[model samples]
Target: MLSTYVDLAVGLVLAFLFLSLLVSGINEGLVRLLSIRSKFLWAFLRDTLDGPDRQGRSFLPAGMRDVFTALPFSRDARPRHNSMPSPAVLSPIPEGEAVAEGELTERLYERVREIDHPKAKRTSIATLPPERFALALMEFASAEPNGVQGLLDKLKAMRSPLHGHLQGIWESSAADVNRFRQQVEVWFDAEMRRLTLLYRRYVRWVVAVLGLVLTLVFSMDALEYGKTLLRDQAFREGVAAIAGGGDQGLTALKDRCTATGDSADPYRCVTEALSSPALVKIFDHALVGVAVPQNGDPQVKWNLGAWWERLISPGHWPGFVLTFAALLFGASFWWDILRRLTGIRSRAGR
Candidate 1:
């Protein structure tokens, strides 16, 4: 009886893991859809562009406030489109030195020159301190209609087509060039913080909505599955057989029953049940097509609609909520737990 209960518990956890993997995939896809990656890049650039020292002195020339622009990024925002280079463009140039990590200065200096003056001699700007790096940008932009001046001119010239997060701030700062950096910094800081909070909030909303939807779709009523295990002796026997499947790996797990922390990590039972062919049949069959009563009873086509009805029936919300709440633990947490269990179980088996 105890073994049967253990089998049931492990089976439920495995089911949760499967659901988590799918839901997490959707969550990550939504991040890309919303361009969260680009938002993060902009936030990071807000700090990097400022460099280490900024006491009312910087590399950008006088006309910079007119055309200062945020670095272009995101899947849709091509680096080659804007005067500012995108993060994605940082790559090894053939017949040249490999740009190492933490060497953004070198990469930017090399890349900007390539765009403006392809034949110019490459400089060792990457090793320079942040202060010098700023000067490098200033010098590079010093050419007629200087680089920075050219950038601002481009922004002005293409005002009709160009739209960016930094564009408005730069345009507005044209009135007060002296305090432009301070005002822009304040605005950038606030916007970045807001984006951070917004991203987190949206993620939770996605998880909750996704969890609830999956619960309804899969008939993952924790209460119902538990009740089914307890009420149906045949089902309990089948699940227990899965949990107690006779295999060398499982036997090793059993042999380690008394090993330290065995109770803390019930990997043996979980591993056996997860590997069970019967468990695979259960989930696969349920997910692929309209489900029907196992016994093919009359007036009992257990299709998606039928499950939806049962899900909305009295006392079903609690079960659905429980399932959804369990999913809030997320897939990464479960993976870490499974890894720990594997280690402890292996030690005990030895």
Candidate 2:
């Protein structure tokens, strides 16, 4: 009986993993389609370099700002049609503080030219590494006669909070050029971590909204699904069996697809993996069995009317909320739990 309960729990978690995977796919799609990474990066860069003043004015010297304007990632360097709301409009950054991650490198510099310069084409860059960003900025500073010192002077002139931060880093290194660069890289890395946290927060809200919609559309009442798994022994055992191996299979599929040197389609590999037969089986078990026809037909017909009825049903509300709350844990979280539970099941079986 305890084993049966474990199987039931595994079955329920497996069901959630499937739903979370679908939601993750949708979130990734939305990110790419909207160029969310690019816009966020741009905003972050703006906040970092320009750092708003107490009066909310840009601290970036006009000369330095012009240099930034010429950079490939800058709004001025791209087509106007590709523009998003200005950093100020999106959200105000703290004075002297830059917003997020991405190394502004010579490669991105060159790539920007290839994509846009000589002719205004393409939207914006999707990613930049922190080390690359530090390298590129150092390269820019190298052009100055005073090199790193000249850069520090420029920073000091701004009297922005960043100047104080960089000054401390500079003094900590005994004003050594190479040490300063390395420290700057570390600083950028810290900023990137903050950016990642911010992005996750934004994604969490997106996931919540998506989870709610999916719950309603698929009639995935978690409470009902759990009850079903508990009552149906054969189904519970089947799900447990699949859960034991699903993670390995999915991981293998992703590894294979990613190894194929296809840079143009970042998600094609994932799409292939998610469309596997195992996922279909999970989907069928989770959603198809949720509702039964009153007329004794085995086929579960889903329609607006049926969905609306469920939406209005007071009993279904808890299920909807439960499902939505479960999804908030995200696909990766569910996958990890599924992997562990599957391991336990395998050990018990042995």
Candidate 3:
């Protein structure tokens, strides 16, 4: 009786885990489909360059302008990349025509003061008017027209993902002389915002439909399942036994379980201990309650009519709602919960 009880409890845990893993796999696909994580980061970078007022008013050095232009959206009306012809380009100022250091530094320092940049590196040269900041960036640009790419190459060598993005921007925008800062700002920032919202709404719909399908396929009606769980006293007791005896359960399990740890667990050894017949039984039992039609079940058919009947049947509505609600908790939530429960149960068995 005790052995049979252990089998049932372990089977229940496995079933719970199976459901969680299914949800996790679908969630991963959904995240990638929408590029949900990367969108915010790209958006943040767009805002940083465009400034709050929607103007091309950032105070970075002018030589670096090409780096920002190639990203996401650029108004570069000219042909771009290696295949296309070049548009109008900014000619670097001749060496002699360029402002001398004392003059340039003074202008830069004054501009820095106007902007009130936090780090004061040029306290000795702040005698000029605030308008020199633009002049300073332009002069800085003129002084080293080709230098920015060299620095960019060095940055690329670092192999960081963000620097790689910067390099890509530079390559795409280097010959793009027609589209200026304002165009890039509008495309990357304002227009991208609309696209992001629309795509996210679409993703939500996909997740809902997917959730309902998974719910029905599993025959996991929350109401019926809840009754099944409640009627089985051993099942409830099994859950409690694995859930850990308050806070000390995990600690106690660790002390007692000589063969189990985070990197290793004895539960896997159960399979090794099983005979071939026992293994077959475990496998067979695992699929016993799954929704897929079984062999020779003449009554079971999943044709369009059956699907329509399932869809319209009021009896399935509560379960469908429960399933979608479970989906809202998401794969990560269930996985984490299961992981904790697993540790608790595995340790308790020791």
Indicate which candidate wins on lDDT.
2
Which has the better lDDT: candidate 1, or candidate 3? 1
Clashing pairs in 1: 141-147
lDDT at 326, model 1 = 82
> TM-score for every candidate vs. truth?
0.44, 0.60, 0.33
C-alpha lDDT of residue 2 in model 2: 86
Q: What does candidate 1's lDDT look like per residue over 30-81, in tens digits?
A: 5544434443432333234323223433222122121112211211211222
Q: What stretches of model 3 exceed 4 Å from their correct place?
A: 1-20, 33-40, 50-209, 216-219, 227-304, 339-350
Poorest lDDT segment (10 consecutive residues) of candidate 3 = 75-84
Instruction: Give me the displacement of residue 61 in model 3, in angstroms.
Output: 29
Please, what is the whole-model Cα lDDT of each candidate in the order they appear? 0.47, 0.58, 0.41
Model 3 agreement with the true structure over 1-350: per-residue lDDT tens digits: 66554544444444444555576678566454433333333233223322222254322212322223332133211111122222234333223324232232232333343433222221221122323422443343444546545434433443222245444544666634222222334334544466456445544565566666666665455544444433343333443465655543343334333445444353433223222222122222121232233345534333445545655678867965765676756656655665565555545467
Ranking by lDDT: 2, 1, 3
Mark the 10 consecutive residues where model 1 has the least summed lDDT: 71-80
Model 2, position 117, has a per-residue lDDT of 22
